[model samples]
Structures are given as C-alpha cells and as structure tokens.
Target: MRKSMPEQNTVPTSHEVGSFFRQSETSLFAIILICGGLLAGLAFLDSGQHGLSLVGLGVALGITFMGFQYGFASGWRRFLQIGDGSAVSLHFILAALCALVFIPVTASGLGPSGSLAPVSVSLFVGAFIFGVGMQLANGCGSGVLFSFGGGSGRMIVALPFFVMGSVIGSVILPTFLTFGSLDPIEIGASLDLSGKLGLNLLLLLGAAGLFFWLGRRQGFGLTKRMLGATILIAVLCWAVFMVSRHPWGVTFGFTLWGAKIANLIGLPIEQTTFWNWPGPQRALTHSVLSDTSSLMDFAMIVGAGLWASLSGAFGKADWPDGAQLFAAAIGGLLMGIGARLGFGCNIGAFLAGTASGSMHGWIWFVMAMAGSVLGIRLRARFGF
Candidate 1:
C-alpha cells in the first residue's frame, strides 16, 4: 500500500506543456537574434573602415525586417497578388523618395556607375524571362533571401538553382551584350529640371500620383504603420547612398558568388567579358566581406530570419510536390539568367535603378510584370 501510494503521475499538465513550448520558442527567437547580430558584427568588421556604413545598413535592414513582420499587411502575400497593384506601386513610391533625398545630397557623384545597365533587346528579353521566373519560383532576389530567412522551404530549393543560373548567365552575358544596346539614361542628366524645380520633385510627384491611383483602384489606403515604415526605409536607403556612394543593389553579389564558385571548379570566369571589367574583376578577386552589396545581402537574410522568428512567422516549411519542386528549380535558373542579362534582379534593376532615375529601371519593371503574368499562369498549371 505504501509503495502504490508512492507512485506519482508523470504526465505533464496542459499548462506545463504550454509553458514549455513558450520557453522553447523564446529560446529559439533569442538564438536567431544573437546569430544575426554576430553576422552583422562580422560583416561590419570585414567592411574595412567602412564599418559604419555597414552598421547603418544592418540596422536599417533589421528595422525593415521588424516592420515587415509587425507593420506591413500580408508582407509576402501582397507581393504575390498580381491582381493587386498596391505592393508594386508602394515600392516605386519608396524608390522615388530615396531618389528625391539622395540626388541633391550626393550631387550626382554616385560611384560604381556601371550598375546602371542600358536598355537593349537583351534587357527586354532577359527581364521578361526573369519576370516569369520570379512568379514561378515565387520569389525575386530579395524575396528569395527574405523568404528563406523566414523559413520557407520552397525558397531554399530555389536559392541554389538561382545561384547556378546566375553563373550561367554571367558566362553567356557577353554574347547578349554584343547584340547592341543604348547607353544608360539618367533622367537628371537629360533634363534641365534639376536647376529649376528639381528633377526629384517631378519624379516623386509622379510616383505619388501613381501610388494614389493604385490605392484607389484597389480600395485601400496606406496605413499609418505602413507609411511610417516606408518613410524609415526611404531614409535608410538614403543613408546607404551616402555611405556607399551608390544606391542599394542586390543581384551583383549573386553573380559574384556564382562566378567565384565557377572559378573554383576550373571554369574560365576570368575570361568572361563581364568579369573582365575592372569593378567586376575586383569584386570577383576580393574577399566577399569587402563587397558592400554582398555584405548587405547577407545582413538582410539574417535580419529577416531574426524578425520572422520573433514574430512567430518562421515555421516549418510545407513539403513541395514533385511538379512544384521542378517548377521552383526551373524558375530559379531563369531568374538567375534573367537578372544577369537584364543587369539586375528586381531590387537592383527595378527599385534601385528607378530610384537612381535610370530609364532601364522603368523598362525592367514593365517587362518583368508582363513576364509575371505569364509566370503566374504557368505556376497554376503546376498546382502551385
């Protein structure tokens, strides 16, 4: 009787179980943030004296991740809603604001001028293909990084292929460039408006008008939080310009990574026309930490992961079906190639380009959107 009385219940109570889960989740979130901070710190140290700028970028991106998690409405979901023009239009507005702030401040001394790709048959072709690919893969360059950080399994599949595609694109880019293209067009350069009313004003006004129209059409208005986030991001972009002496960019890092891998595997990356250029060559030869764009990209992914974990947005990813997996791989390849041929992915070519007043940005946007429509249709066929 005394032995039987000594037997105690071993099952955890519901409250105990709940508390355990909460503690585990909190621990996981803390780990992610700590890791992100470490990565950012390493990137800053590796930035060689430009550590301040890297720090600025890391903090800004971290804030942006938090905003995406807490402020924005349906962050990733909005980007995929082709029928709703809000997300695209709002981003354009953000770019416009960045341009309005940085142009006068920088006095047009933005270095690394080669980031601006000229309009050409290859650009249209590549952008169109990229557009399709983004839709099929369900992520753009920035999108893929953030989605992966947010624990999306599909994006993980797309990432490697995207890198491979970028390498292939770099290999073939010289051929595409030989097809002939126009010189890069800078709006401020061609117009006398910068002297009188300021060209940035016109650009900002036009973007604002478009945003308003799109919002009305969609029966939505920018929330206070969203507006605040946009303003913050715009300022961050301006800071990036001030420090880096160039607008924000993303895909170049991918190309660099791809080329490096190719080089390591006995590929003649140095012989490629694109890599032969001074800037590209320097990036290819140097440590990745010294590459500003690459550092920012790395920070962005870590920041996204940290924020997603804190917000409970990071979760186990759903398994993809065979067809879906195939679509992701193919889409990633197309996106990689398209990004190189078109001069950038969505962030580089479209957002940064437009903000910097390059006509190619507008061209990339139109072509990519058109491609997106087709991509969406293709995605449906794959039951995505």
Candidate 2:
C-alpha cells in the first residue's frame, strides 16, 4: 500500500497512522471504532437505524473494496492495456442484478430512490474528464477512498485537491445546466415494476453482450479473487440500497465536504445558485455526521486504513517525486471537477444510476470509456 514520494514535513506520515490503526484493529479498538460511528450517527441523525445502517454499510464497502482490490480505474486500465474484459463484464452484470432489485424496491415505495441526473453537455464533458482524471490519479471516487484507507501517500495528496475541485465544480454547475441539458430520463418510468424490470434487464443484457463480443479475445471470465469479491460487494451494495433507500454513492459526499470547507473559509457558497436549491441548501446547513453519503465516505476511509495496516501496507513510507505529486494534484483536481459536473463518478453515476433504471447512467459509461482511452495515451506522455 505504501509508495515512493518526496518528503515535506516532520509530521508522522499516514503510513504511521495506518500502522497504529492496523495494530489497534485486532484489539477492542476495532469494536469501539465501529460502535463510535454507529452511536454517533444514531445520536445525530433523525433516521436512527437507517443512518446507522449506512455507517455499517460504509465500513463493509471499505473492507470489501480493499480486500478484493476491485476498482474501476484499474479495471478499465487493464481492459485497455491487455484486453481483459472480466472486470468490465462483471460490473455490467453487477449493475444488472442491482437493477433487478432496485426497480422493485423503487416501485414498492419503501423510500429508496435512484441516482438520476440530467442529460446535458456538462454530463458528457464531466464524465470524460473524470475518466481522464481517474486514469491519471490511478483511482476513481471509490478507488481514491479505499486506496487512502490502504495507506497510499499519493492518494492522500490527491484527495484534498479533489475536494477543492468539487467545490469549484459545484459553484459552476448551475451554468452547465443551461447548455442543452435534458431533464433526467428515467427508463421505463411510466411502466409497472414488472415492465421496468424486464426493460432494464433487456437493456443490461444488450450492453453485456456488446462488451463480451468486443473483448472476446480474452473472454469475460473473472478470476477467483474477482469473483469472490464481486459476490460479497454486490450483496453489500444490495443491503445498502435496502437500508438507505438509495443506491450506493461516493462523489457527492466529497462535494459536500468541499462545500462545508468552503463555508468555513468564508466563501458565499450558500448564496450560490446550486447551493440555494432545497437539497444543497439542506446539505449546507446540516452536520457532516447527519449526511448519509458523507458518513459513508468517512467510515470507508477508516475501514480501508485499518485493513491496509493489517496487510502491512504501511511498512514503508516513501514520498513521491515532485513530478508524481504534481501529476496526482492535477488528477485530483480534474476528478473533483468532473465528478461534480458529471453528477458522479463510476459508483454514483454508472452503477447506482443504471441500477436505479436511469438512462443517464448508460450515457456516463460510454463517455467515460472514451475518456479512459484518452487518459491512457496521456499516461504515456507523462511517463506514468
């Protein structure tokens, strides 16, 4: 989990933090840490168990993410480099399965909602930019969070800038909405649950078939590692949707974090057009602890870090060269801006949206893939 980087301060590195946490994880500290999150959430939020459930879900996601090392950026990179479609194919399957469950859940009116976003020029440009950034940073939204958990120095560097970019994006997003955007197009919205399920499944099958054909050379079979991880991760995601009444998401939490920080720094964020909206307005006024997505993000980082420590990922703490740090900064900034402009990263837009039967999810996937291709080429020029 440790990587080479240039030193800057006398402070103990995150590697040290990882090591300490790793050691503590086997002790009563682990239980306390988890309980702390649960208790805090329960106490702070009106949703009670539902909010605590999100905390638990976030920890589960972190553990699963690190354990399997399943990631969007790496998966796409491998597909582009070696023509392995296993990961790519598996994601589509995962989304399809989630859709099967989510469509019914939404219809049942149990409180769960889909990750729907408008179809706009911003969405197209943002997804593509996010793709490029993920490749440059070597992680997507989930990838960055878990990678940080696993004691990655480069990720630590990228994270703050990513936050900065998200804040900036949020400020500019309302303008993007003016650029030929269409209202969110929910697939089969007028249909019954059964109709939605069939239509969604049919569409998923078509997409999966296309992927399989395109990468048939290496085939689409997952390795034992990936298969096990996928099963566990998929189940966890389902549980999260059931409890949270929303599909899994990550980027919005970062954006919220940025927004909060901006408020602290005296930015007139609350007055901005985007923030003035009811949803953003509420978010701006609430504690981070009360926000489901933000809480999840926090838990995931802690979970990944403890896991990384156990894996001995913090044994070494080498600082990256200036060039590498510079690259990471640029990557983080782009990803942050892109995520906000695009409505989400892979997890939020592609996985959650598609699962919730939103057409924008499919659009995000196509554009992001194209962006990944460009990212790969840029990677060569940057000597990555």
Candidate 1 local distance difference test against the native? 0.72
lDDT of 2 by residue, 176-264 (tens): 88888999999998988888889998988677666666677776555677767877888888898877778888988898999998889
Q: How many collisions between residues are there in candidate 1?
A: 0
- Candidate 1, residues 1-384, lDDT tens digits: the string is 455566775744445533454556667678767876676567656765585466557546754844464311133234447334455556766877877755555554445332366888789988999988888887788777777666666777888899899888888887987888899887667555375226655765576667567666767566677667777777777777777777777777777888888889998888878888899999998977678777777777767766666666544334466677788889889999999899888777887777766789889877987788788778888887
lDDT value, candidate 2, whole model = 0.81
TM-score of each: 0.84, 0.88
Model 1: weakest 10-residue lDDT segment is 69-78
lDDT of 1 at 223: 69
Model 2 CA RMSD to the hidden true structure, in angstroms = 5.1
Identify the runs in model 2 with alpha carbons over 4 angstroms from their true place.
Answer: 1-47, 316-319
- What overall lDDT goes with each candidate model? 0.72, 0.81
